[model samples]
Target: MIYYLFQWLDDFGVPGARLMDYITFRSGCALVLSLFIAVIFGRKIIDRLQMMQVGEIIRDLGLEGQMKKTGTPTMGGVIIIIAILVPCLLVGNIGNVYMALMLIATLWLGVLGGLDDYIKVHRHDKDGLKGKFKIVGQIGLGLMVGLTMVFSPDIVMRENVEMRNVENSEVVIEYVQEDVKTPQTTIPFVKNNNFDYSWLTSWMGRGATAGGWILFVLVVIFVVTATSNGANLTDGLDGLATGTSAIIGTALAIMAYLGANIIYSSYLNIMYIPGSEELVVYMAAFIGALVGFLWYNAYPAQVFMGDTGSLTIGGIIAVFAILIRKELLLPILCAIFFVEDLSVIIQVAYFKITKKRYGEGRRVFKMTPLHHHFQKQGGIVTALIQKPMQAIPESKIVTRFWIVGIMLAVITFVTLKIR
Candidate 1:
């Protein structure tokens, strides 16, 4: 709202109001405002949650410090959601299609996560919402995002093609004649970072374009669902998900800025997505919210984000990458989430296979979700990889994982230059 007010004031020749015209200025303001809101109001929200008995239902997992976290206020994700939405509404350009899509994605996933947390807390169902229901919600969001990217007239991108100036012995990159809608995304370690989905369906000849869109939609659904689930699983530790998300958000903000700027896009030889600069404002808010949440959510956590924060954070990162045509970079950028996700899958699959063949469920890690495996003391649970007999401290484990996440973020950024 403040953004629109400033726009009106600028129309009336107000000197300072014109500052809002710069994306950097607006994004900076949004960041500070969101951080202020989250840090100032977070404690009060945690108090209210404790008063309402909205505590986590902890299962008896034998990991160190597991029981101690029981009854910590969950659903503190509401704080992050508020922090993000308020700043974006006040400072973001709501008319931009990118901004609209982000807002929609935030609310859609926020509500879905809120419902899951509600069931776990209020309804006393540890299982929370049924797996199928969560999948349905994720699918619904993926479908909406995919369709919007395809159908929204404002969501076109200007492809940057390289050229050589023979007379001057210089090389240059230029955008196509006009912005056109295409299912092209940035792929790392390639001569041309842009990879168009349409090429996969070239065998269809005239129908290849439609087939490409269908393929894109499926990819969207898969990415949204997988990343959301990965984040949910990674939320097992204090500040793990929140801190890692903030790091990823920072990288994404840079990517959005580059993709949206014609000069940077040309220099980097990446797709020029007009109007995507608005996403920088949104991401600024996102980073601020997570950092603020971390104030209470860090070691000896005062509050837990539950599914509410984790799912929304993951969804936001996924959609933002897709919007900027950098979804292909997620595997590297979100390496922590992916590794945590893969750990569980491998552990579960191995356990089931061993049980079926040998009549006893053998283990891979001492526990699933990788992080907990580090927290678990060896020999207590039968697992294959048990070199570290002593359990690592939770805080230390979290810090190490964060270090890994930071390294991954650096690698993700380097890919652009390396390519």
Candidate 2:
């Protein structure tokens, strides 16, 4: 909104209106505005939730201070959603295809998550939304995003092509003059690493392109579902999910900025995604929202984000990466969320197998979700690798995880050039 006004004024030779032409300026404004909104208005939202009796339901998991978090005002994710939306709408290129998809993804997942939070808090349903319904919603969003990438003429990329010097066998990278539409993504640690989903279906001959897109859509569905659930599982500790998401969002913002610039992208030997620069403005708001939400979400929390924030945050990260063709790099950038996810999977699978064979269920970690495992004292549950004799402090665990997240972000950037 404000962006267009300044853009129009610039065309009329208005002084200083051209500042909006710089993505950095707009992104900085968005960051400050979103932070102000979240910090200043977030308390009122928390108070309103308390007035509505939207308290969280905490189960006793036998960890330190487990019961103290009970009755914390839940559904505070509305604060984050609002903070992100307002700033992006005002400062971002509202007409850009990438920005449009980001806003859509934010609102779409926000609603889905809000409904689940409503069920859990208002209706007092421990189950919240059904698993099938949640998966369906994720699948619906994945299809929308994937199909848009296939059909939208504006969503195109100039892939970096590699040239090898015969004299010295040295490799040089160059960009194509024309943009191309394809389901190609970058793979780390490999030369000429543009991996295409269509290659898997190139055997289809006449229908190869269509088959490739279908495969990409399936990948989208899986990525959205897995990432969202990973976030949901990681939300157990105060500020864990929120802080980790901020780190990931910051890395993504840097990636979006570089990928959107032709010169920077060419120098880095990566894809040049025209118009993805708009995503930098959107991600600025995203990082701001998460950081602001952290103010109240830190240790000894005043509020909980519940399903609303976690699902929406995860969806935004997944869709943003997909839009910028960096979805393949999520394994490194989003390692924390996936690690938390894998902990639960390992615990459950091991317990079931042991119970069936030995007539007694065995444990892997003292509790599922890797963070909780660290916070728990070792127990005699026939578990494996319970070496932490004493429980660690919540705040320290969160800080250490954040440091790891930063290292992973650095690794994610390095992977582009390491290839």
Please, what are the lDDT tens digits per residue for candidate 1 over residues 157-226? Answer: 9988888999997989988989899888999988678999999999999999998998998999989998
Lowest lDDT sum, 10 consecutive residues, model 1, at: 380-389
Best by TM-score: 1
Model 2's number of clashes is 0
Q: Which 10 consecutive positions of candidate 2 have the poorest summed lDDT? A: 378-387
- In model 2, what are the clashing residue pairs, if there are any? none
> Model 1, clash count?
1
- RMSD of candidate 1 to true structure, Å: 1.0
Off by over 4 Å in 1: none
Query: Each prediction's Cα lDDT score?
Result: 0.92, 0.92
Candidate 1 Cα deviation (angstroms), residue 384: 1.5
Query: Considering every candidate listed, which one attains the maximal lDDT?
Result: 1
Displacement of residue 169 (Cα, Å) in model 2 is 7.4
Question: Which runs in model 2 stand beyond 4 Å of their true positions?
Answer: 164-171
